[model samples]
Target: MNSAGTWATVTSGISFSQFENVLGVLDVPAMSKNTFLKKEVEVEKVWLKHIDNALVEAGIEERRLAIEKGDVDDGMPFITVIVDGGWSKRSYGHNYTATSGMAVIIAERTGQLLFLGVRNKYCCICDRATKIGMEAKPHLCYKNWDENKPSTAMEQDINVEGFKMSEKMHGVRYKYFVGDGDSSVYAKLVQNVSYGRTIQKLECANHCIKNYTGHLHKLAADKTFPPDSRKLLKQSIPRLTAAARGAIRHCADEGETVDDSISDLKNWPYHVFGEHAQCRNYFCQKVESNENLKIITNAKLLDEITALVSRLEQKAPRLIKNKTSNAAEFYMSLLAKYNCGKRINLGQRGSFQRRCYVAGSERSCLGTKPI
Candidate 1:
């Protein structure tokens, strides 16, 4: 029991020493050193194996619950999933790059994690065997690698591989693949898979908003507009994004068709800044006043905003349904904290590093009841 509790603590991003201190402070009787002959190495191996088993079981259980609740059809098993990756350098002087590619299927209606998958290339067999007093063996080598130009292409393949495995093991028939601006993710997922062409790509709205805001920021730096007006325009970027999100939500609530939603979204700029009085649905009360409109008199700034609106309008069909990857972002934050926050190497190049994964999977499974 103490061993299990200790492993659970470590899985939750707590250092082992901190776990001991916490237990000592709480007057909890933890495992004694004699339990395993003080073999820290063996303890970690056993704990990580347990975590891996638990993750697999939790995914299967989640799929079962979703089926029972009719969230996933027993025959179809289709789900909506979000994809993201974590890249970190160990800060060792060598400038090595290690990327952890992750995929998570969350409840479409509730946005809770259903399954999580991760891949990284840190499993060099010769390096491991040499550490354990064994001869180098190339036969045991396995790599989650791609020989494509621009190594980041490997990230797309890893993500697709993980998703496909989830489909096979958990009966995941993904209906939507939510991600950021990376076009490669969509292209890769659609090639050579069962539901590839059927999966719809949903771009994260927060990322889109950030991109628009960046364009606005650059435009605001032009020095042609009045400095005071420039400040107002800079301040308006957030308001613009918020208003656009509200408009999208309104269309979604009204059950607007894709074409209608895109049409409505295209009018966001006019609806926001037009000469309308206190219309109750207006995001800004002062838009009716001429003084507020004059602050954005700069032709280039307004054009940039128009361009942004036009782009969003074109993508409104996708953005109208689900607009954010906030859940996936939250999970990734936990993964990072578990990995390198306390200076632990849990996110190191190999699959044996399960702390980050354990943190994500355990929290997803236990933090909330199946919904």
Candidate 2:
């Protein structure tokens, strides 16, 4: 194998089973184990033979699906229905244990990934959360340090027999490439990226503000835009501010530092230069940096929130709590009620007017009354 191939193998995750040898044996009721085995075998057979075969025939040598468009789903698209056995760590706590796995489905649509992870059994009989085909398809997998072979998470993941739905769309045109069909991880990544995308969606406040400011600077130079377009911007300015505020508030709910978050728009290289400038993708170029990424990730979740609030200020001049009032009473309560070291009282008793005096100001001692 080539150098890159060798590296890939070294870093690649272990096989799906990753569980100990089942000795090709089990003790579940004949009905349960029998049914499970048949379904498992059929899934693997189809995945390896159908999906794998089609992708390879079209143009694929490996299954480490990456973050891009894969060949279209064949009418028989590839599907890997995975499941897990009780053994997570060692397989069998004793000398040996049975190997178990789950099977899920996969397919290509509009160049993005689509996955369906199903669960078969629930840890507790009363826990409906783990039941098979439990709607919403939310991932219920988890890890059990005490288990042997199949990790706790994997065990839940493999219960159901997931499969591709629209085998009909074998030939069509669409957009967006789903990253390495890691549906679970991909879904989260897509969400995170989408959130990032929203933040970077448009230069509403700063961009427009800067543009307006620049326009003022160039008032004497070639002024071509009609007054109506200028009016459109002025009107849009408020919406952008609202959007910025929403972004900050939403990020706050996630316990994230909305300010430090980068703009997803930055990723759309075209934003900086090209016909795609107005396109959401192009306009959504995100600003990425270590400090910023941390905020986006809500790693420490420190000053980022304040920064977001500051951005909110820039976006919506009216939203700024320049004066103390009860308008944001509910939001203010969060500061006092939060586990974090957020200050609840403004040192004065009245209502929240502006953003808590910007954290650390010598004037904070001035009491609840306006300084």
Candidate 3:
């Protein structure tokens, strides 16, 4: 029965009723829903204990690697980590009404989950009790977020909590953080978490390039630009994306120093537009003929592209590191498999957090010995 309940939550994201129906279809005897719920409580306890142990082991390994890599500062180990946040419901980048949100921190060195947290804005028992105008029964409530706070605020809050507890939980500090372009989380960390040193923010390479692509697409669809300019901008999207990605790869592979990589990245826009005077030979052979180059002839379009390049240049230092939050993103994707597209309200009874524990344990234990 406990195994069945575990499967229902970790693999199927099905309620006990759904599991019972499946059992009935198979002509197999199933435990009562009340009994199943009791077993699920046990399952949650076991998974939580396992996840705690796994995180501790991962932290130890991360610290050892950081020291070996000379990432320590003044005898204190500092590791670079990737972080990302996800919501129970899809916001589509506009709507922010998800009742639950989660964020995770993964060590860049070991690709292991260091910390994870979830926030909930609703609790089934509390809401039910309120509806009846009576005192709620004592229960493990999952509601931590205030009703007045926006759902979007959950990400920053969870991230701040994770950062503040890093040293205490893992015996190491997250000196460098690789996250998406969101500045609010980083700003909060700078203000709240006191590691007795500065925490540097590293921009995710993929997000940076993605944002650049989005900007070009937005410009292409704008009516203010001349039709010719818009057409040129549309045509330049693929080329610009390719150029940016190639530049990042080349810089990462061949550049001797971070400064060299930044210089190379800053010069890529000019090279793509047939202004190769500053181009490196290794990057572009500088063919004598400009006939093959799709040079932007529109002055306005050229200015816009130049401005975009300048904006990207300002982020060159962060991009040169080439660090990414892909691991954290992958963990979120795995989490979606368990949560099953927000179709069920798992947050009401602390079930959402237990599911998260399963996901984190699966990720942290992947290709590793079982705890």
Candidate 4:
């Protein structure tokens, strides 16, 4: 067993019934038994041994981060765990489909579980399960007097809030986190990670598959070169990303129209027009055809381009002043849009390094942020 030290967390998925309140609390800090002291389902009854294995499995590398779960914080040992009652089971076409709700636990040291609640993945999680007004604050959330369920977006917000509260109690740091398959839940948590020009180790996580952008697929089409040559090109993906972003920006700035004739065709092919190929070519044709002649990696040119954007935003002429907002917002949108709740997921050369995918649609999400 890993030694109990700094902070540790355990998580599990359970049925709604298992989330019933016993000590006036639902799941964490203490699991409230049902009226008849009902026994738990085999799946919900995960043992400490299993939690033990999971803790190590949850570790960053070969060893665990915390000596024990209790060392989280003195007053509030913020912990979050999930029961991945996925929404995939639900059918949107049919009349309706039932789904087991996701459950979570937030606890403190001495094994006192603080918060326990179940939330449905597809339907409304903001409903009050009981008819009672909020009796007390249930772990940074309002617990209605008679409800067995949460009253806000607490199901997802709690994890975000727990980290904040724990940080407030102690100092904010990535002690440890426990989560499951709910992509939405994970995305909310990842937004808290640090990302900028300098920070090397960004705190993030995701399970979403990275999908390649149109421009990358086309770039990789040349298979004539042997494996070694292609490997070299792949390694220099930073060049690809930088080149594409620069080309797109220049073209857009000049109002150079790139025809998207294929994007709206009646039956778009699965691998249509190559990832970002049309856009990249359009950029090259417009303002700077010489931009990518010698560029080999997206990495080498990053500092220069970033500095250019910064200078343009700070000292560009008045007529072109507002254009900086477009530039800033475009990348900001990309950062948020490309991420699909996967932990530390990244893409390269306009395609997913591993998988290319986006979660639920957010109309406002536009382009990637500087990571």
Candidate 5:
């Protein structure tokens, strides 16, 4: 049990379930704990107790910084926060689920996690305790354990509660919320009195790229494009979108105002797709010119690219809140690993919450290592 628990912390949360698997592939019966599966519940109980202790330690660190800075009421000194949610199945083939929401404060200068918050969703049965006329999810009686709130509520109780806790602890709400264009989270922040003031929304660059390329793939499927041209265009989507973003940034750097930068971004595809392309000025050699590209001269494909650019421009910021949700996504992977790789045990709610708390603590210590 001691070895398994230590291994989990050392690996930043590879669960005890992986212990037997690791030993099976290794020659080290020396480190082997054959009882990991049999003693899983006890091991997790020990692990979770430590996680609670770690959270208290992190909060103390926050308070120490606050006292030193003489700004106990000023909130972790962050104007922006990146927020995202993740969900995983509790068991391999079970209806039970685990959902968590996380928020990370980023330093303006260094862009590191100044603070992190994680909250797990709770499932409960609301008999006569259930509110009348409340629309909850089919499986969940309450959205969360708190006040038996309806399960389908917009800002998920866990996520909003996490933010509210941060505000109380740190003393100020983030001025700008960065996320993957999930309006529900944003809407909740906007509606909250603590966070509503001068709140700006930033869509993640990675999500923006994913969304922009979706349209490109749709255009690629049109039969109007020849097979070869379709292949070329499909391959070009990422390159083209990257170049478009670069152009927008370059325009801003060259003293263009936000409106001008957005205007330039909106008109970028039309100006760059032609033989005498203006992309070379900003994106350099990213835009490849091809005689075969003439095959895509169909007005429909051109219009599709135009619309995509317009949509991209609207979502793409002249200065993003954060470059990507890579940190958030990587942290989610870490959470999964703690839950025992791809297979999670949703059987015990407390166990899942312990995993979540441990993952968040480990993430805080990690400080966004390369990737």
Candidate 6:
């Protein structure tokens, strides 16, 4: 029975009905829905316990690394962490109607999950009772979010909760926060989470570059630009993004000071637009190349691209840290696999949370023995 439940939820995000169908095709008797639900409850308990233990161990490792690296304040270890959030439904960068959302904090040193939180805006028992015009029977309610709050706000709330509980859940303080370009989460942490000191925000290099790429693509698609200008902009996006990424890498690895790094990044646009006067020796070798080889020639288009590069320059200091939320992102991808591509509404019950726990456990225990 336990194996059946694990296969249904952990191995594949299939409903009991689908599981029964598979069993029928195999000429095997299927467990009743009630039995499957009971078994799933047991599996949830086990996975939750495993996640708790993994978090505790991860925290211990983080503290040890902090101490070893001399990142201590007044005898308290301080560590850096990467945070990111994911929604159960696909938003495609616009829609935010997901009924459930999840966020995670991963220690930078150990690359293990330290904490995770989920916010669900649905309850199957209550929904069923309301549909039938009857009172909700006593059952495990999964809804925990306020209906009045927008779904997009769930990530900030979950992140704040994780930051606030850091000290109580783990003995160390999150001195540095590495996340995407969203300032709301960091702002909330600064305003709400009391860590006895300020939390420094570090930008994920990939996200910063991705945002720059997105702006260039947006400009290419805009109707304001002429057809030839748009074609040129579209063709230049790959080189532009590559140059941005290379600037970041050079600044992070080669530059001596923050100002130096920022200056190098700021000069990248000029070098790419055929002005190599400010180009560093390592960044550009063909200073003698003709200006006609420049990809961006339109004055207005040059101004727009320069404006975009300036935005990236403002974030150069953060990008120099070279920190990323990739571990958290990998865990979210694992969650999606277990959640089965948003085809099923797992959040309607405890199934969504249970599946999340399974993913957390898998991520936390990666490269180790199975829990």
Q: By TM-score, who's the top model here? A: 6
Each model's TM-score?
0.72, 0.19, 0.90, 0.24, 0.68, 0.92
Q: What is the lDDT of residue 26 in candidate 1?
A: 97
Q: Give the whole-model CA lDDT for all candidates, comma-separated.
A: 0.61, 0.27, 0.79, 0.28, 0.55, 0.80
* TM-score for candidate 3, residues paired by index: 0.90
Residues 1-371, candidate 1: write the lDDT tens digits: 66566555555566556667778999986666444223334455664565556546656665776577676644666666677654433535343345444455554445555555555554555557768999866452334543223335545765677667766666657677678888887888889566688878887877877787787787778797678767767777676777777767776777767776665555555445554443334344544445555556444456667777788787777777755777667766666666646355433324224554555655555544432
**Local accuracy of candidate 4 as per-residue lDDT tens digits, 87-108:** 1123343523322222222221
lDDT by residue (tens digit), candidate 6, 214-323: 99999999887677777877876887788888877777776567687778767766666567777778767765545422545553777888788888778877888667
Cα RMSD of all models vs. native, in order, equals 5.8, 26.1, 2.9, 19.2, 7.3, 2.6
Model 2, stretches more than 4 Å misplaced? 1-36, 57-304, 309-371
Model 2 RMSD in Å is 26.1
Query: Which run of 10 residues does model 3 get worst, by summed lDDT?
Result: 290-299
- Per-residue lDDT over 55-97 for candidate 3, one digit per residue giving the tens place of the 0 to 100 score: 8998989888887888887678899889899888888889989
Q: Which one is best on lDDT?
A: 6
TM-score order of candidates, top first:
6, 3, 1, 5, 4, 2
Clashes of each: 1, 51, 0, 52, 2, 0
- Model 6: lDDT equals 0.80
- Compared with the true structure, what per-residue lDDT tens digits does model 2 show for residues 251-300? 44455442333341122112221223333432244433333223222332
- Number of colliding residue pairs in model 3: 0
Could you give me the TM-score of model 4 versus the true structure? Answer: 0.24
lDDT of 2 at 272: 21
Model 3 spans with C-alpha error above 4 angstroms: 15-21, 27-34, 255-259, 289-295, 367-371
Off by over 4 Å in 1: 1-75, 89-96, 99-101, 109-115, 123-143, 146-151, 224-226, 271-274, 277-287, 342-352, 367-371
* Candidate 3, residue 316: how far the Cα is off, in Å: 0.9
Off by over 4 Å in 4: 1-43, 48-118, 121-155, 164-172, 175-371
